[model samples]
Target: MKRYARILAFGAALAATVISSSAAQAETILKASHQFPGGKGDIRDEMVQLIAREVAAAKVGLTIQVFPGSSLFKPNDQWNAVTRGLLDITSFPLDYASGRHPEFSATLMPGLVGNFDRAMRLNDSPFMKNIKSIIEKQGAIVIADAWLSGAFASKKGCITAPDTMKGQVIRAAGPAFEEMLAAAGASIGSMPSSEIYSGMQTGVLDAANTSSASFVSYRLFEQVKCLTAPGENALWFMYEPVLMSKRIFEGLNADQQKAILAAGEKAEAYFNEEVRKGDQLMIDTFKKAGVEVVEMSKADYDAWLAIAKQSAYKNFAAKVPGGEKLIEEALAVK
Candidate 1:
């Protein structure tokens, strides 16, 4: 009888232990938000969605719930949400928070990133290191680094040289670009990229500058009369990264964290492969719509760069602390 009692007690203890372990390993769900069209092949939305799929496949008790097209949070408001842990993850445009951190203006500075190759190099350069450090200090960390090449579209005419910007009201994505456009004699209006189509439709915007993917996804080809596609010397490039709340990430178990990191790597690789295709698709979509498409000539790019140096570059160097050094670091990437 004593032996039987001991065996029963051992079985009970094992059952309790198993229950405890299962409870400890309960599924964790992370909420991710972005301002891009969901289920429509927008690469930005797909990046977050891909991470969700990859992490779930790892079976590490992690799940990601994505809220795209600003359903969960406003586009410009997402940065603060991630920092404060209100949102677990986000696909954020770094420049949208330039007002909070002046140094971020450098991320979207005019003519800073000329093309995709330089963008990849800049990811590993001191410039991005500094930017990432700031992100960490602010309670967020970059999961995937994405640089999107953009173009200028106008209902008025093609925006090629600084002189062409005269008498046009344009939506430049960041302060640095705003300074350059204003110097080039274009009127500046502040709005998120998601609103560009409506802004133009309502006659509030005569021209706009944004990512090729956004231009395509938002169907801006229907609104603008002329599209300045990014050619060899692309001028507009912005760093839009997948970001996670540092506190939330740190709270995750080791297996969960590993899954998240691996997913991020996959998402970054996917973006690099698909981004160029997005640009071409925008060009084709616009041309098929009968909207005139043009590219900036080498001379035209040089002219814009000279104007940016005088206005955007000069102002950034003078205003933001260590801003000049940041620009120098990016330029040194070659």
Candidate 2:
């Protein structure tokens, strides 16, 4: 009878432990938010979903519930929202936080890194280390850094030279882009990507500078008649940050953190692949839409670069704190 009683007690303890573990697993749900629309099917959205799905699959007692399209906070407010623990996770434009850390704005500066590969390497280097520290100081963790390829879409003729941009009102999204447009002799208007089509239709904007992928996602080709052929100019790339709220991250177990980081690294690779492919697709889509795509001459490209070096770089470095160092490091990337 004594032996039987001991056996029963052990069974009960095991059952209780199993139930407790189940409860712990069920309780570990992470809420993630993004400015991109949930149903958009864009690369950013796809990458975020990939992270969520993979993280959950790892079964690290964590699940990520995504709130996309700024459902929880506006695009510009996402960084602070995550930092303040209002959200568990978020992905936002790093340049959008320029107001908080001017060095972050360096991501948007024209002609910083030559191409996506170099840009990605630099982002994972010490250049990003400084920015990461600053972002962490605001109470968030940077998991992934990604970029998009910028292109020129217009309603009129293809823009082949810097001078062609003069007198045209171009819509620019971030600060560096705004400066880039203004320096090129085009009037700049700050507008969200969602409003771009309407802006073009209403004559509020004559041309716009944005990622090739975004041009397709936003369906700007329907309104714009031309796209400077792919690689016509240095594509304006925007740095995207996949961040986690420090409070929530700190609450996670070490195993869960490892799972999340692993998922993030995978997502980063997938995100870059999608961006590169999407950029090419956008260029192809533009050509199919009867849009005139023009390639600028090397001389023209050099001229624009010269203007960017003289005006965009000088002005950006002067205004943004640590901007010079950021530029120096970015350019130094081999």
Candidate 3:
């Protein structure tokens, strides 16, 4: 009887231990948020999903819970939410935060950084290192950087020269963009991309500037009749920052950090490829939609660059601490 009793006690103890161990192995949930609608199927969402998959594969006890379409916060509030640890991760355009960190406006500066290859190199270069330190000071870590090709859409007609843009009511997103359009003699109304389509249909806007992805996502093609050529003035290559709260990142173990970084690298590569392919598809779609694609003259492009160098850079430098240094480093990245 004593031996049977001992055997029962041992079995119970082993079962309890197994249950506790299993509980401990359960995945930790990390919440990620973005401003886009969940159904949009944008590249940003794809990258987040990729990270979640990688985390699961590594069996690191980490799981990502994505909050799409700004359910937790609006697009402009995303940075603050992430920094305050309300969101574990987020990806957004750096230009959106220029009011908080004016140097970030450099990311949208006209004629500053052109082409994906050059932009990618600059992202990993010393320029990003400095920018990263600044962002960290605000309580977030920038893990990946990417550029989306921008284009101009007009409700009335195509604009092929700076002179033709005069008196146009153009909807632009950032101060630098507003300045660029203003320099080209267009009347500027700054608004979020979400508001652009309606702004055009109601005649609140005559032109709008955005990426090809945006044109399609917002269905702006239905209202706009033309798309400026891809390479002309490089439109406005928006830079996206893949960021996480500093506290969340620091709490991770070393091995976990390695997995996150590795996954981020893969996400970055995939993002670049997707943006390129998406741009081409958008171009083809625009052509099929009967949108006239026009390229600006070299002289006009040069004139715009000269104006940006003199006015935009100076205005931006005055607003941001160490802004000129940031610009110099970015331009020097080659």
Candidate 4:
């Protein structure tokens, strides 16, 4: 009977070792989704892969499964998906969630951010701290800050003046931008950037303002006759950071959480470099496709800014919480 008892103890000890081994090898997988495609050398795809690689390098049993091109969730639904725990992470345009979280509207307010350098600086500002608190309250965390400069695509001609928007049905990325166009005399049709192609195809949209990467990725040049491409003089830049669910992030082990954040930092640098490259790529692609590529000049930008302040900025400050102060800090980036 004593021998049998000893044998039973030994069996229990072996089972415990096996269980420990399995636990050590288990991977903590977070599914990351985005509205862009996973293309070869595509910055969005490449950066996501970098994040995955960094987490793996940490050897903390943490990894990310990427669902690019909005396969996991649509662009408009990503924030809701992540916050509700239906999705774990996303490369989200903060402005897209402005409807639900009005404070996010200021992130894409016209004339607030135009250059990558200033956008990076904004990340360290008290304004960003306030934005972070607002987002955290909504159950998400900003993992990476991405400032992707964008441009205007038009069906008939270059969109230079407020009058150029008159009577046109445009797809502006955010409500703030739409308000500016409306105040200038344009009909607004809200849709995610990914749907710009279809909107143009159906003739429902006469113009769109979107990221440089998306301009090329969706081949808007084929549908539109002209593009006000991103460059040294552009006011269409956007803040589309990669975000993770606060619930998921907080539930992670310390090592795993650190790995995720470290990976995000690395990916953000990649984003800045590649987004600039994308701007040039969009210009080349549009020109090569026989689309007239117009650039915003000092005068043109000033005109847009004038209207934006009176319409977009004013509307945002009046509606979104703390938006006026946020705009003050954003414009002070100089």
RMSD of each: 3.5, 3.5, 3.0, 3.8
* Tens digits of per-residue lDDT for model 3, 177-240: 7887798799987777767888998889999887767777777878888888666457467787
Worst 10 residues of 3 by lDDT: 229-238
Candidate with top TM-score is 1
Which wins on TM-score, candidate 2 or candidate 3? 3
Residue lDDT tens for model 2, 1-334: 9999999999999999999998786668888887675776778777789899999898778888988866777787888888999888887878777877777777777666657788778876778788788889999998877887777877876786788888899887677767766877899877767678889999999999876667877788888878875473564777876898988898889999999899899989898777778767887888788787776677877777788778778877788777788788777778
C-alpha lDDT (0 to 100) for residue 67 of candidate 2: 83
Residue 326, candidate 4: Cα error in Å is: 1.3
What does candidate 1's lDDT look like per residue over 184-204, in tens digits? 899998999999999999999
lDDT of 3 at 77: 87
TM-score attained by model 3:
0.90
Model 2 worst lDDT run, 10 consecutive residues: 228-237
Error of 4 at 319 (Å): 1.9
Residue by residue across 180-280, what tens digits does model 4's lDDT show? 88888999998898899999999999999988888888878889998987666778878888888999999999989998999999999878777777888
TM-score per candidate, chains pooled: 0.93, 0.89, 0.90, 0.91
Better of 1 and 3 by TM-score: 1
Count steric clashes of candidate 4.
Answer: 0
- List pairs with backbone clashes in candidate 1: none
Query: What range of 10 consecutive residues in model 1 has the weakest lDDT sum?
Result: 20-29
Candidate 2, overall lDDT?
0.79
* Model 2 regions lying over 4 Å from their true place: 1-26
